[model samples]
Target: MTPPLAVDIDGTLTDSNRALDPRVLDPIREWPEPVVVATGKALPYPVGLCEFLGIPVRVIAENGGAVYLADDDELEFHGDREAAQRVVEEYRELGHEVGYGKVDFTNRWRETELAVNLDQPLEPLKELAAAHGMHVFDTGYAYHVTSPGVDKGEGLRAVCDRLGVGIEEFAVVGDSENDAAAFELAGTAVAVANADETAKAAADHVTEGSYGDGFLEALDSLRDA
Candidate 1:
């Protein structure tokens, strides 16, 4: 049996603008290689894709900071809650503005992390963080403020640790900066053809197509391997 292959849903699997090829998901469900959708998108995106693809189960949401097993309706969240709360409280203490969504949905510490929704741009956020002795991390959508160091890379590492799978056994696929870590973690890092240049550069290989077709490309790569 093949180890789990962690895949990204949005640009790597299906283009929200276009429908996914149901044929692709068939291999994932029937083949020995089990697939896990690792996406930076929120719960809704992964859930919808899973439903549309008839994948009833699969997906690591919020860039692997949270994992949801649709088949079991169970969630395993990552992140240090106490640490995140301390950071949030610190932000409050410092009077820095912050914005977040889906926070109260789960009280678990490991599932939630400190995310700074940027009202402006990263340069300003970096300047502010540097002035405050805080670290600013990039995640494509936001300039994340963290205690010292934390991001999707660490989150992907955690998932691999829990699953007891090594990089040699799995393929990590994604289409954004957050996906960078998983790219390094898994043996083969697959980036969608539509992925930004930065992402493509970091990837071990670029998919032949976009979204749905890109997934097929990665699947082909898997078969070739």
Candidate 2:
């Protein structure tokens, strides 16, 4: 079997506005192997989107803090949940906008990481997280606070193990600083035209288009490979 395709959501599958092109769904579902939706978004949103698109696949949510397999409909958390929660409280105490409770409805379903709206600069947040022995990642959509060792690369590695695939057989598509780890893990790392410099620099191929168009371009390349 072909290695699975792991893709980031915010700036890869969807545009800046979080709008997915309907055209990408059919091809994705028709792909030869599994299509894992790896993202910084919470589990529900990605799982819901996959359902609506009629695409059955596993999901790596909360920026590698959790994994949800659609077949079994189970969520397996990978990060230190208590530590993630503590970081949220710490961020809140530090006067950052950390979304918990009803602060951000879109972020309500997350369990292992804290998602902060992009109302402030991320460098300070990263610094603060480091002070607390945590890590902060900017996903172009939000800032994710996770345990120091957690990242999308780990999530993809887990997915590969569960599916009996190897990292060298996988193709990863992403467009943010948070995507750097997974890009490093993939045999073929593709960055959309709109990708942040760090992500692009980590990629093996940079697409000419942004969002879904870029994803489609990468998918074509992978198929032709």
Candidate 3:
């Protein structure tokens, strides 16, 4: 049986500019594991990447805030609708320029969460977040904003609740301040060497190396553990 696998995208799966490393992809292609790509990128992005990897049907996108389960052999949506709306409402009230995510008929989640793209500057974004009593930080090419207390950790916990699994039953890998909280709860938390200092500090362990090279190394550790 495939041991359950939960991997992160962005800096974890790809390099700094959203580039995929064939070296890492090779191992994952043959990995005897249930791989899930968790990231802040909503449908079409990670979804398409997972498909290219020939592993579709399941993905935890938009950070841990959304989950996609293939419908009729094709993915359409993530988890609860009500919860997503509630969270979006809270985020908007916090003054973020939030927008609902509805890719190919999936609305289980309804917010962009953050704008981490090559089209914007970070300073103004930080000032805006500061003025609104929120926080904005970068994760490679994306920016994250949430009321003083919400993020991937909260979403990961929701995943645990939905799955009826304990924190110790899973492993998580990522590379940013956003990834810190969830790392605390995982059975094994790994940060790639190229990760920001904050992520490395919070990590239960650091990946043996950088990005793609390091991810493959970390997976071996999880399989061994």
Most TM-score-accurate candidate: 2
List the candidates ranked by TM-score, beginning with the highest: 2, 3, 1
> What TM-score fits each model?
0.67, 0.90, 0.72
Best by lDDT: 2
How high is the CA lDDT of each candidate model?
Answer: 0.63, 0.81, 0.64
Error of 1 at 16 (Å): 7.1
**Model 3: which residue pairs collide?**
39-63, 67-78, 100-110, 116-141, 116-142, 116-143
What are the per-residue Cα lDDT tens digits for candidate 1 across 144-199?
Answer: 45444344555556555655566567777777776776777677788888777767
Query: Which of 1 and 2 is ahead in TM-score?
Result: 2
How many clashing pairs per prediction, in order? 5, 0, 6
Model 3 superposed RMSD (Cα): 6.0
Stronger candidate by lDDT (2 vs 3): 2
lDDT digits (tens) for residues 102-151 of candidate 2: 65775577788777777765776777777777887777677787887688
